[model samples]
Target: MGWLAAGDQYEVALIEGRVAARATSGRAAGRQLKSLPKALRDHPEVDRLRRFAEWLDRHAAACVAQTDLWMVSSLPVPTGLLARVWPDEAWQSALRDLAVVGDDPDEVGFLRDATEAGELRVVNLDGETVRLSPATVTLPHPVLLPDLDDLREFAAELGVVQKVEQIHRATWRKPADLADNATTVTEFSGGTYDSRFALAARATSLGYRVTGGYATCRVRDTGAIVEASVWIGEPYWDDEVTTGGLSWQDLDGRTLPLREVGPVAWSEGMRMAAALHAGRRVEEGKDT
Candidate 1:
């Protein structure tokens, strides 16, 4: 699953086939996030950066219910946090293993179960730390147009779905600042500025997911929080196209404004589609 915000509006892409999640330039709404002040953004500004990271980290876990928080780069979160989330013995071990693993129903179920255990403490599986609250989706900037689709028919064919019971179109427009580039965009990848994007994928599988709204699961890889966007059995194609700025969203489960809500809907919509499939599992068993 890949999401890009357009001004206040955001688009979530549920991909399948050769195409993975894609984020084009101007896809997400370029909203100013509650970022750490410049003084604290780096190591030298430890006093300032530490305070901001702490505050942002807290919000990420608290603001979004049942989700995981992540960023485009792992720089924002310090290693001190890694030691705090896991046992010192296991901490280093787990910290070495933070990479996006596509939606493993087992992990989802595990998260569902873990949160029930308590406030859902953070975990370190390697160099990466984990959160079970709101998981963030980051981009260099907003995607004016990213890969999207309306796959009611395709999802139904998968047998995991009963039907595309509903398809809703919600759009919102907001003011945004655009330039040749942004300082916030500290990095760029092979992904293009056009409709094509290099989106987050499962470290272990090709399948992508765009659902499971309450929480996000991210694995840290190469000092970046690698969160998988797509889940198993999602559809990704449609001739229909639209353009807007990239959008921003909290990995948290808080309600985003309609504009910022598009990607979230994509996440919700995919789960609903999968739910359509899960229900079938029940009926089949009842018939037996």
Candidate 2:
């Protein structure tokens, strides 16, 4: 952003997401000040820069959240859409170094760049840079990535840190030996919370929706949408409560059998349950 005239002797601009001031006609002319000068702290230009910085922060967070949603759903994002947003630093930060699959699912690579002409440059597992111009690409969830461990290792070697969690996201696979009629898992049950509000707060903080008496997460699994939910407590209850079993439900609200639960749904449900249980209060010096 261009520096704005803050006062006769000072100019202000945003530097590294912060308001910075510089002298215009003194010994420190043309040099950025270590801190915003006292006179410019409340200056109109300085205030504007600070507000701009706040907006940038919110924009960056929103970009990361959107990117995470795409990856979790394993949605096919159009190449043109990526190219259009590639110029934006906030979008770029969220997308850079993410694992991407083009037309051929076997050919997985770490996204490096998106060209204006809808082409993408990526570094594959074989350590080769390749360009792909497929109409669409999928940022598959980690659970669906066949070479997830290899990708994690390669990312570490490349010093890649994704702003949106992808390669390192925790995943679970449904077991094939589950009983046909079983509908819920009790592994995360018995988590005690001091109050219903505290439990609901934890659910929301972990990005899960607390509705009615359950903490819920929806996932697209095997062409069908499923909701994985764990019973928290009544929304209006003020007394202490304990978490209940985790289960999956179909669109019609029928509880799905454990054996019928898809991998993504099972994993996401368990993830939410585990996160909520982890926040439960533990007795001092007792096994958690």
Candidate 3:
């Protein structure tokens, strides 16, 4: 009780800061609204955005606390829309750890090919947690170290990797009923890409004006058209697929083998998005 009383002034100051968080919320909502095209305006998605804006307004200060917990805590996000919709540090970090340990859900699903997976058995070193695993599984450098920078990177890597994993698995889990309007297939490209999605991500990272579209490329002049699909949503627009397996003769000729890329994890997001996308009623507070 005495300790609580001692920190009463600091608590008041924190609550005062929360009351003044309107400016922060306004700026974020402004940035989000400006990015939408005129077509998305008045759409149901827009309503979701507006509600998101309002939630930001209500939780701006709470978000600050959540952010602190996310960054400072060694906890994992596990699964929650609160993180995807309004990502906290913990959610981001979990994904980062996921990517670092090679369980990257986005870039590629777990190469479930192996029964024995190498794990980074983290051990506490002094006051921090350090990953304990063979350095051979990774470079003998920062990954095993206990450092804030490493954790920050780990979280970023996970979010991106999960997106990668999301593509191969998206449609099968649940997808664009409009999947009929758009066809997905593996196509060919001539350009040398270390990683198509990674390459595209770097370009967008530097603030380049870019849009996802099919480009004809060649592997030694084979002249294959590579069609890469991208999705635009909150946070970042992402590349969904890049295929160099088909012929341009197909997209133009309108007859081709098709396969959609996505992750098995999206079954939850899909069931929700599909219900919404398909204009089916979803009861509030319902959990799948």
By lDDT, who's the top model here?
2
What ranking of all candidate models by lDDT puts the best one first? 2, 3, 1
lDDT of 1 by residue, 218-243 (tens): 33333333232322222232222111
Q: Give the TM-score of each candidate.
A: 0.20, 0.95, 0.21
Pairs that clash in candidate 2: none
lDDT of 2: 0.91
- Backbone clash total for model 3 is 28
Off by over 4 Å in 3: 1-12, 20-258, 264-272, 277-288
Clash number by candidate, in order: 68, 0, 28
Best by TM-score: 2
When summed lDDT is taken over every stretch of 10 residues in candidate 3, the lowest stretch is 1-10
lDDT of 3 by residue, 30-108 (tens): 1222233444345453354456556655565454444333322212332223224323433333333222222231121
